[model samples]
Target: MQQATPLQARVEGGGTPTMANWSLGSEAGVLKDVLLGPPEGFRWMGLENAAWSSLVRDTLRRGYSFDKQLAMRQHREMVSAYEDAGVTCHFLPLDEYNPYQVYARDSSFMTPYGAVICQMANPRRRGEYAACLRFYLERGIPIYDMVSSGNFEGGDFNIIGEKTALVGYTDHRSEEIAARQVAGWMKDEGWEIRFAPIDQFYVHIDLMVCMLNERCAAVCLETTEDDIVDWLKARQIEIIPASFKETMALGCNVVALGNDRVLSTAGAKDLNTKLRAAGFTVYDPDMTMFTWAGGGVHCMCQPLNREAA
Candidate 1:
């Protein structure tokens, strides 16, 4: 596995890449550079009252307290885990206004062409992508394009392999029009897009399916459509089914660090045990506090550079 050059090192060695142009061809590629949302910005600002998902409201109603200091510590450990895997981790600038910005994966996605800025579904998250745009511009990373159709979130875009992406649509977060528009862009880029219709209970495609390695995926079969499963099978992707109980525990929301390694929460024992049995090195970090804000490991990091397998 090859470690990708850090953005700073890339700039210093190659003299600032072209503005708005970046390259990320595969999700299971050797991860070199990544963007981890800053946990320092995690704050409870009463936005839960107006949360788009009843699940989030329910979590809030349960009197779940999110500790900012603890979250920061947990994020540090996760970053350390990435470092141990030879991944270069970058972070988003803190935005006190957008507390949920810590889920960096929802703001933008990296493609072979460049970064595609997403149009957020929630009003509270509308400006988070702008911060990512700023980082790309300042660091000389190219911006491939921006989503203009209805509402789109990066969480719905799941890159499975080279030249392929699994895009999802949930009425609460991503619209079919938005998915179609993304599919069009991918088609123009000479890539295939598998449009997956998601259940309302889940937030994104990543929430139900995560690529774990070159040929394996951690999938929540209950919410995954049969056609989507067939598509994965057609591509020879091995499915590691996670039960509904494990899915609610965010077991499917794992992050692949290239090789046969995955990062997940310590609470995801069933999925972790299965992944380990499948020869994957699982790194479980305690991120229970982060989930209280309504997401898991996969939601916190965005891959900036992946060496195509």
Candidate 2:
């Protein structure tokens, strides 16, 4: 059995030591283990923070129905795709009150050192940190730190390259203060932090920008600022554009399984086709039940162990 590590692993003066067992250098590395949330208790949060998420608001406006059984089936399919890719899946303990816990990427995110717990913006979702905390502790994964400044979610913490990250905030779900707090930690560790301040309607940076591999990414030029795009280009990283319509629909949100493999949704036909043409093996699962609820596969998962890029 693995010995449990301390809840706080971050060094006060920075230069925290990296975990020997739990390693993740970049998002595009070969995914060996991933963290997921339970889908059994998932349900639509009608009128509860609906104003905070444009996708949820639009779903309510369109009078779309929520089918729990369908959601479970879709979630299983997503897991199957991950398993087929040889990625081990770890799930958080279930909490009936946190139905939105199915979107696992919001509560906390993994780093090279440990997991950084986040502060949820919505009151209804704040309890999610408990399950996240329990999971990491039980698994002996170190806890790097927690976001105490303001509201911040895991989706906004996007790692684009080695020692480089794109931290985003909307002043709504993820505030600038919290983004800086997290950025400060990364900066002190000799990382290059790029702040992307986007509109609240977009939710998180992962919604419009997700790394496809070490050298490529799927980005929504319409939603992403010019400076961010230029920065990526400056690093010789290729950009794969996703239409604004598709991006808002959560089509651009995807996961890189390394070796040119991607986990995308069936709704992302255009991007999936483009990815396939680019010699990538894509796993397109029907995730409308979750996507319509305002999160996608990327939003539903957190990488725990990724082979160094």
Best by lDDT: 2
- List, residue by residue over 1-309, the lDDT tens digit for candidate 1: 744323332221223333333457777877888897777778755554335654476576788876778888888988998999999999888888888888899888777666778888888789897789778777766666678888888889998988789989886788899888878877765678888887667878888899998899999888788889989989999999998876776678998888888888887888899999999998999887777667788888889887666
Error of 1 at 213 (Å): 0.7
Error of 2 at 59 (Å): 0.6
Compared with the true structure, model 2 gives a TM-score of 0.98
lDDT of 2: 0.94
TM-scores of the models, in the order given:
0.90, 0.98
> What does candidate 2's lDDT look like per residue over 167-274, in tens digits?
999999999999999999989889899999999989999999999999999999999999999999999999999999889999999999999999999999999999
| Worst window of 10 by summed lDDT in candidate 1 | 7-16
Give candidate 1 regions above 4 Å deviation: 1-22, 45-50
